[model samples]
Target: MLSRTLLCVAFASASTPLLADTVWLKNGDKLTGTIKVFDGGKLLLNTKYAGDIPLDWKEIKTLESDQHLLVKQDATTGEISKSLQPAEDGKVTLANGDAPKTVELASIQQIMKPKPVVTDLVWKGNIDAALDFQRAENDTDDYNIAFKTSATHGQWRHNAKGEYNRESQDSLTTTNNWDAEYSVDRFFTDKWFWDGRITYKRDTIEDLARQRTVGTGPGYQFWDDELGAFKVGALLNRTDFEYSNGEKDNFYSVSGTWDYNRYLIGKKVEFFTNGEVGKPISGVADYSLETEVGLRYKVTEWASLNLKAEKDIISGSDNGDLDKTRYTAGFGVAW
Candidate 1:
């Protein structure tokens, strides 16, 4: 039995010369039989017994052999041979034009393999619950409640969110708000994606009046599989007053955002900034800018506390109209 094993080993070694070959460097250098890989700026070759060989781009002139060839010219890929050769003395030969030039094989830089895009599917979703007791100087102090949930599957995603706020003065009237937003994400690549969203908000002015709005837009999401994500997009929204004296209005709104997830701290955390530039396309409302910046701290694995301050931007409008700034801080949980 041992003799049989020894015979197999000897056979493998004998055939290794064909199955594996050497890559000759123009600088009187050589690499034994190995597999080669090229990355952004590096060159590499791997040998079964030895390991990987790294080479500098400047050190190589051309890669060629009787069997295979890989050469890069003007920039990369100067093929020294008719076809791209694989696993020779070098991963590929640096194409320096058709001229003969002396290069140091020792100076050859081995390339590194590209970071493989993980095919492993990862899915994460969460719900959020929050309550807010806010103080507005010279205005109404109110309690606000909100909920948000989101999930992603491969290139497609879904997000749902809703908020309800009950606003009351120290002794006067009360106001109530109900809002909901839903979005779908479509991916072009891991780095680039577009999403579509529909949103609606209804406000009851504490028994005095009610107002509502509906809108939709296409947006971009820069969601890194690692780190956090940011989104930028536009919305065409219109508001109608059912029992209020305010004018009805339709708006062309552009928005941008930057966000970060909890990476440094073990606890969940996120920082976000967003802004919108809007122009009233119909009815009578002023063009405006609205910006907000905030931070969120995880209260649990599926929930967090959110705090935000916002300001409105006004341009091309004379009157203040319905333009106002709001500051919001709240805590919410999810499972």
Candidate 2:
């Protein structure tokens, strides 16, 4: 009976999964979890009891993990280590091959899981939808949906986005519009890139019934990491517009565009904004501006609540000027 009990215990131990990553803090607290990633001066750990916890890199005294991870010490160079071993204070040992290497924690720029096969490809995006309906007195209905997606491989990146909005009051259409855009970027260096984009928009009820644009320019990528990303560009565009009465106009324009986002509060909240502004060389339109700003609060790992505001303006159009603004609160899923 004693032998059988020992055999059962050994089998159970062998079948259990291991969560062996450990971190020792400067304040004498020790934590056990799976190391997720380290970026922007924060080391993220996934704990069974507390979900994900972000520890300041400066507060970590030492850490150990058996998982192979990529440790980047600089912008252009990195190495994959078989395991991380605790070294002296403020240092870590990369146990790779027979010769173990030790380095200062402060010198490590980033740490993440190494993807051997698909290391060059990354994809991420989000979708949001909002709707409002009322049945008292004058009936009303409003709906908005939008999606943006991007993928990067090697030195090239591709982006696509689309949005639809519709509203009705008293069984009459008050607003109806949709837009779509696609863009590509080719990196000349780590921070510099060339951008080419095409966009189309249509509004059934507005004076400016349709718009089409094509543009190309140089852009600067300030930074892109686990925390967030920011980029800005200047574009010279060929634009065409069709009015509700079928009047057509075309012009050449110069524009500035920007996209930015940042994560905060242990990745629980995010702030993002992107926009473009342009002035026409001819009199088709004096100036045009389109922009959106938004915030998202993560309700769970993959779910969020979002609030957004958008503005569109076109001055000096032959069919008169155009201006519109919208605000929305909605739910979204992101990855």
Candidate 3:
């Protein structure tokens, strides 16, 4: 009976998945967890007891992992190793089947799990919605929703975004508008790309009822990583405007666009902003600008609370000048 009980306990332990990664700190404390990624001078570790933890790379003495990983040294391309073996303090060994390479910890630039295939696609995006209702002297209703998504495969990336808003007071509509845009980028190098985009907007209660634009430009990606990304571009656009009184105008424009985001406090909070500013060559409008800045706080792994402000301005439309500003607080999901 005693032998049978011991065998049963051993079997259960063998069946459980092992947290095979280990990191040793300079202060003589040892940690066991799965290594997630290392970037921006931080190494992320996943542990069952404490969740994901970010450790400063400088504080690490040595680390080892049995899982296959890609280790990037300095700025060179990464090499995959079957496992990491502990070496002397401040050094590690990358063990393959026949070749074992030892390198200093300070020389390692990044570490991450290797993708299953070289051309694997990655997709990420988020959606947010807000609603307000008042039932007093002046009944008011307002609704707003926005979404943005992107997919990247190899050297190509595709992006799409849209927004809808409506507001009513005393059973009368005061604002209604919707807009959508799609863009594609083709990379010629790691940090440089060309982009083509098309956009359309419609306003049901405004004099400038419709706007359409097509543009192409060159962009520079400053950086993209687990923490955040920022990119800027300049475009030459052909735009058409239609007014409610059967008036139409078309013109060429020069524009600049930017998108930026950052994560803070161990990825609990995010700051984001994206916008476009343009000057029309034909004087259809003195200038046009559309922008939104927002912050999101993660409430859970996938859900978040968001606050945002948006501005839309057309300085000299044919029918009249248009300027609007809106503030929103809402909940969202991000992946």
Candidate 4:
């Protein structure tokens, strides 16, 4: 009886199978793991021992899995299929337990695992803060905190951002500014979108106590890819402002905005700039412009070091020298 029990245990151990996705490399290396994603020239693989490994897609000669994945080469050619067979001569065969389909290596843009449960909405963003204090002969303090969050579902996206800044010297506040904005973008085509935004702002240092703006416009994407993207738009804005000098003003404005961002060093470092220009039809200022240029270097998956410079310009205002420039360097986190 003891011998039969040992034999049964041995049979069970031998029959238990190990299931994994497989990748064949150009240099005759084989990797077995759970394939997570193929995006931006890289493949993310989750393994039992190594946690997560990022492999260059160019180095992979072929991939195979029993799992179903969605593959896309262009706008119209996309399908969900079972597995990828090994590559021969820079092409791979996809097997869906039926007749195999072959595709070129270079034409593939994205590969995603099909989820058992459908999920449409996704969220991503970043936040950063900076602080500086000096307590020598004269005490000084400065700080800024900002966060941006975005969500996307199907052809629609929503973004929200907030920022706060303050500065003081010798127990006297020299600067204070804060702003919050919410925006929505609806994509009608690949490169064109319609956007609407609402913004609330306050600046005690600029002698503007409060400002509110609502705008809507069309935007165009010049290019959006793995490396970077550029977008520009124009909006007709209605703004209401209250100044410290007991002046309350409201007017319409023509506003233009530009946003550009690029990634470097395998997407660990990023350079970005976003700016806005506003010309009031009948208000206290002829023109108002604000721009921010920044660099973010990723320290890890969640943390990064960031440096930023900001310039705010206002022309033809009744207030004296409302223009300002500031620089900040600090750390940030993202998920």
Over the stretch 66-148, how does candidate 2's per-residue lDDT look in tens digits?
99898888654578899999999999999998999999999997788876675534678899988899999999999999999
lDDT of each residue in 1-335, candidate 1, tens digit only: 99999999999898785645445555977676544544223445556665556545445544443323333222222333323233344344333346534444443322212222422223344333344444666456576565555665446767776666666666454656676777776766444556666666566652214434455556665543323446666666664434345534344444433333433243356766655566666434446565657677877665677777756454543223444455677765544
TM-score of each: 0.49, 0.80, 0.80, 0.74
Error of 4 at 120 (Å): 3.7
TM-score of 4: 0.74
Worst 10 residues of 2 by lDDT: 114-123
Candidate 4 Cα outliers beyond 4 Å, as residue runs? 1-118
- Candidate 3, residues 32-92, lDDT tens digits: the string is 9999888667788888787778788999999999988988874436788899999999999
User: Which residue runs does candidate 1 get wrong by more than 4 Å?
Assistant: 1-141, 206-218, 235-243, 250-268, 289-291, 310-320
Query: Every model's Cα RMSD, please?
Result: 13.1, 3.9, 4.1, 5.4
lDDT of 4 by residue, 11-52 (tens): 999999888999888898899999877755677787887766
The whole-model lDDT of each prediction reads 0.51, 0.90, 0.90, 0.83
Clash pairs, candidate 2, are none
Candidate with top lDDT is 2
Candidate 2 Cα errors over 4 Å, as ranges: 2-18, 22-33, 38-64, 70-111, 114-117
